[model samples]
Target: MTDIYRKLYTSSMMPSINLPKHYNYIGAFLSLSCNLSCSYCINHLVGLDQRRKHLSGAEWVEGLNRIQTEGPLPISLQGGEPSIHKGFIEILNGLRKDLNVDLLTNLQFDPHKFMDLVDPERFKRDLPYPSIRVSYHPETMDLAETVNKVKILHDNGYSIGLFTVAHPDALEYIPAAEQACEENGILFKTKEFLGEHNGKLHGTYHYEGSVFSKEVKTVNCKTSELLISPEGHIYRCHHDLYNKITPVGHILDPKFQIDDIFRECTYFGKCNPCDVKRKNNRFQNFGHCSVEIQDIE
Candidate 1:
């Protein structure tokens, strides 16, 4: 095991809740509920036993406004389906301008409403990829319909793309979707499936035995990023936040802040592969994990 202990840099480095200083990024789960329930959905992987909490439009604006994002990085608004959030548009326009805004949706809503409500500049970016990423689920969604929506949004000057998961069952459909997207002049891409499939684990992960296993152990974990649950609670790892296994603080509280510190966790075996996996950084460069966990003692 690799144990990396260095100077705590970000506001998330404190052990206890305090004011967030250098927030690399902020994610607000507007709502965990989705319109289409894909079988391969990671949100449903651990079973939805965890309590679901949602913030109203006003509450979301208040919580999101408090975040201090660094650089051009924006607060990624995602959920089981971000569009499902009741206050989706209000929350988008409500965020402070200093804090850039991004959205990850399923394109399950009315595009006319979206275009009328959100300003294209609000999601503008100099980055290579679109600021708004829409997931296209083959089993639950029609490619033609999805593409049409993308076209409408694209024509309206919205920066967007269609992202699909490469599940084993749906692998064959991705090429077809890509072809359709190409014909329509749209940006389409596939993401590796990251869960159990036909008794085999998939996706690239940095840590061994972190997924599809029953064994558990203790370890010291540190995170360079900020993770917020749908209810506004902050977490140390994707596992603790997504599974509701544990949390450090809630953003709803005015006094809550990102406390960056190495905390002992016993659910090492249950950790989400996304957290431990060595993957691409924000620059799309290889070698990055949502969390940096080590010191397995």
Candidate 2:
């Protein structure tokens, strides 16, 4: 007797997760387990729970298909490393035809296998950033190896880019690494290191006391992001996400709805840097923030 796997719910059965008008990002945390443990990962700054259950590839496909969106924004697949998910390729192939996707990885996975299984067109999109952003961690990964993998993927039609964080410890090594990537026809960029390094906190935040400040206060916060965890739990912010705080809703629930309004947060001072960081919006505009915080109480 043969059997077929069934989806938990159909798109029709589930309510649409209407995205906000000014929403800048839609991040889907496919898996939070990384092969290389970087000390500066923001997820760990707020205490990440890696033991949480990850939704199966089919479940992820079913859950994400219910999202209602428009414009240049694509559902970003990220994590400790999104590629580590056992069903990573399947999830890529399973998203609905209308939805495009992006990936943030460390380039540690088998690129050849990825190329063989995934159609690069799935991630291709007309955007300022590449569909796949590979991080080059000099602390744990070899730069030559990273560049080679990226070159191969790029040569194979994958829209890929390489980047590194300018952590104080890692700064001296970036110039050479950038040269290597450029030599191979790969565009490399650097991101601001946003965590503690050698006893001093390093980051620029929009909120006065949202991150790295030793102050904890209550405030009304609104998010312009859809932060889904590995288990399909949607959270208000990255702080709530890494800490595994109460989620707004579960993706699989028929009653799940997205409230793009400010909600009370007593842990405002303890926010994850990602939430309060001043960064670029979807249009590549400067000075974009993921959450709006007001009504201090």
Which pairs clash (backbone N, Cα, C closer than 3 Å) in model 1? 12-259, 12-260, 13-260, 14-259, 14-260, 206-277
Local error of candidate 2 at residue 284 (angstroms): 1.1
Off by over 4 Å in 1: 1-24, 48-51
Candidate whose lDDT is highest: 2
Prediction 1 TM-score vs. true: 0.89
lDDT of the candidates, in the order given: 0.75, 0.84
Q: Tell me model 1's lDDT, rounded to 2 decimals.
A: 0.75
At residue 255, give the lDDT of candidate 2. Answer: 69
Model 2 agreement with the true structure over 199-225: per-residue lDDT tens digits: 887777887767766878888899999
The Cα error of candidate 2 at residue 184, in Å, is 1.2
Write one digit per residue (lDDT tens) for candidate 1, span 1-297: 001111322223423333344334467777777888788888886654255867677666766676654457667898878887778878888877767777899998888888888888888865667888999998899989999999999888999999998899999899889998899889998888888888888878877776666988888877866777777778887788777867786665644666677889888878887677676655577777666668754
- Superposed by TM-score, candidate 2 places the C-alpha of residue 283 at a distance from the truth, in angstroms, of 1.4
